[model samples]
Target: MALRTEELMLNMGPQHPSTHGVLRLVVTLDGENIIEVQPDIGYLHSSVEKMMEHRTYFQNVSLTDRGMDYLIALQNEEVYCLAVERLAGIEVPERARYIRVVMNELQRIASHLVWLGTWGIDLGATTVFLWCFREREMIMDLFEQVTGGRLHHAYYRIGGVYADLPEGWAEQCQRFVDYFLPRVDEYDALLTANPIFLARTRGVGVISRRDAIAMGASGPVARASGIALDVRKEEPYEVYDRMQFDVPVQSEGDCFARYRVRLEEMRQSARIIRQALRGLPPGEIRTRVPMTMKAPRGEVYVRTESARGDLGIFLVSDGGETPYRVKIRAPSFSNLYALTEMMKGWKVADVIAILGSIDIVLSDVDR
Candidate 1:
C-alpha cells in the first residue's frame, strides 16, 4: 500500500467572495475538481417562521412574506391571503386583483434585479451589479408611490390590497416600463453577449429534467434544466390564468440556460404587466377582515409562482385566531438543495457560476 490518501479539504466561504452572503461552504477538492460541496446555512436564521405563530393571521402575512423570497416583498403575503381566504371563503374585489398583478410583477422586476446584480457579481462582472441596481431603484420608486414603503410594503392584505393603485399610477408605470424595456438590450450588450461571459456560463452546470425533479428543484433552475414546472401556468392562482405569456424553457440545463431564462422571463413579466394594466378592471382593493382572524378548522395549501418559483404555503388552522402551523415551501430553499449535486466535479470558479445559476436567498433557505 504505497498511498491511502483522500482529497484535500478546503473551506470556501461563510465570508468568501463567491459564497454570496454569509454562506460557509465546506468543499472537498481533488486537484482542481470539487469532490463535494457541503453548504452550511442557518447563520442568518432569525426564527421568522417561529415568529409567525406569535403574530395574528393578518400580522404574520408581512412577516412570512419577507422570508419566502426576500427579493419580492408582499408576494408571499398575497399567497397567505389566498390560503386563508380559501379557508374562510372570503371574496376579493376585481380592482384588488388588478393591484395584486401590478405589485406582483413590479416586485418580480425588483427581485430579478437583485438576482441579476448578485449573479453578475458572482460571475466576475461587477459593473452589471450597478446597472441592475439602477433599474431596481426605478421599480422601488413605483412601489413607494403606491404603497408608501420601499422594502416590506405590507401592501398586500388578507382580503385585498392595502389600498388602490395610487393617483395617476398607470401613467407612472407606463413611463417606467417603456423606458425600462429598452435597457434589457443594454444588459445583453454588457454581459450576455460578451465572449468571456459565454465561456464561463455556457455549459457550466447541467442538471437533467429527471434529476432536477427528483432533487426537488423548482423555478428557473428547474426550467432551465428543461423542466416545465411553473406554478403560474400549472396551477393558476391570481390573474395568471387570463394573462398572456409563455414559460421560457431550455434543454441545456446549464448556467447560460438559467441566465437566458431569467432574461426572457423579465420580458414575460413586463408583458403580463402591460396586459394587466390595459385590461385592469376596476373594483375594491381589499376585503374587510378584523385585526384577528379565526380560520375554519381545515388545512390549505396555497402556491403561487413567485419570482423564484413555487412559493407554497401550507397553513393548518385549528379553527383558532391564528394558524397552528405555517409551512412555507420556499423555492430558493428547494433550488439550493440541488447545488451540492451540481457543484461536484466543478472548479472553484465554476462554483460561483453554479450558485449564481441556482439563484438562492439565504433568508428563504433558513426560514
Candidate 2:
C-alpha cells in the first residue's frame, strides 16, 4: 500500500484583520503544518523619505508625525529632531529634556496599550481589548491636554518642544500614573497565567538567539530572545540616562516571552514617567530658533527607542532649507522579515497568534 500527501497553499491577508494592515501572507502548508511563510507587504507604501526631502526641517515634523509609524508619532519626531539638533549644535534646555522624557514614556505606554488591546482581540480575549483601551484613553486625554492633538502631535521642534505643560498637567499626569499601575496588575491576573493564553503562546513561534540577532530584531522581540539591546540603556537620549529603569529580557524567545517583555515594559515606562515628573526642572520649554531651520552640510544618523523598536533616522543636510536626503530605518520593516522564521513548522491557526505577538504595524513596514 502507498499513500500520497499533497502540500497546499493559502493566502492569509491583504484585507485580513490579523495582518494589522494591508499585509498579505502566502503560506505553504504540508497538511496542518506550515512548510514556508512568505510575507507580502508594500500594499500601504508611501514615499515618506522622499516627502521629508521636499519639506523644511520644521514642516517635516508634521510629515514625520503622519508618515511613518502613526502610532509612535512622537518617537518619529524625536529622532528627526535629534538629527537636526545635533547638526545645528542646539542644546535642549534641562526642563524641556525632562518633559520630552515624560512625554516619550507616556507615548510608549499608549503605543503598548494599543498593542496589548489589539493583541488581545487577535488572541480572542475581547474583554482585554476593552480594558486596555480604557487605560489608553486616559493617556490620550493627557496627551491632548498638553499637545492639543492626540495622535498626530507635532509638538516636538528642531530645538525643543513647541510649548510648556499646561496648568495642573503635572498633577494630572502623576494621578494617571498612580491609577494606571494597578490596571497592569489586573491584566496579569487576566492573561499571564490563563491556560488558554499559555497554551496558544508558550513554546510557539520560537526564535533562537542566533536567528534573532542575525535578522536585526530589536526591542522586545530581540530582548525576548535573550538579546540585551535596548537603545535607551545602550545609548541614552533626552533624560533617559538620568532616569532609572530596567530593560526586561526573556530567554524563551517565544510568543509568551514577547508578551511578558511588553507587559513588564509598560510598568517600567510608568516608573520612568514618574521619575521624570519628580525631577523635571523649571526652565524655558524651547530654545530660540528661526522658523526656517537649516543644519550644517553633513550627514547624521540618530536612533531612538520607539514603541515598535529601534527607529533610526539618517539625514543628509546640504546647508539648505530642506534636507538633501532622508532615510528612515523603520523597525517593522526588518521585523516583518523575521516572521517567516517564526511561522515555519507552526499550524495556520498559530499564524494569528505569532503575528499578534510581534505586534507589527504595516505602516511601519511599508514606509
What stretches of model 1 exceed 4 Å from their correct place? 1-6
Best by lDDT: 2
Against the hidden true structure, what lDDT does model 2 obtain?
0.91
Q: Write the per-residue lDDT of candidate 2 for residues 146-212, one digit (tens) a residue.
A: 9999999999987889989999999999999999999999999999989999999999999999999
Q: Distance from true position, residue 228, model 2, in Å?
A: 1.1
Report the Cα lDDT for residue 31, model 2: 88
What TM-score fits each model?
Answer: 0.96, 0.99
Local lDDT at 125 for model 1: 91
| C-alpha lDDT score of every prediction, in listed order | 0.84, 0.91
lDDT of 2 at 356: 88
Question: Where does candidate 1 have its weakest 10-residue lDDT segment?
Answer: 64-73
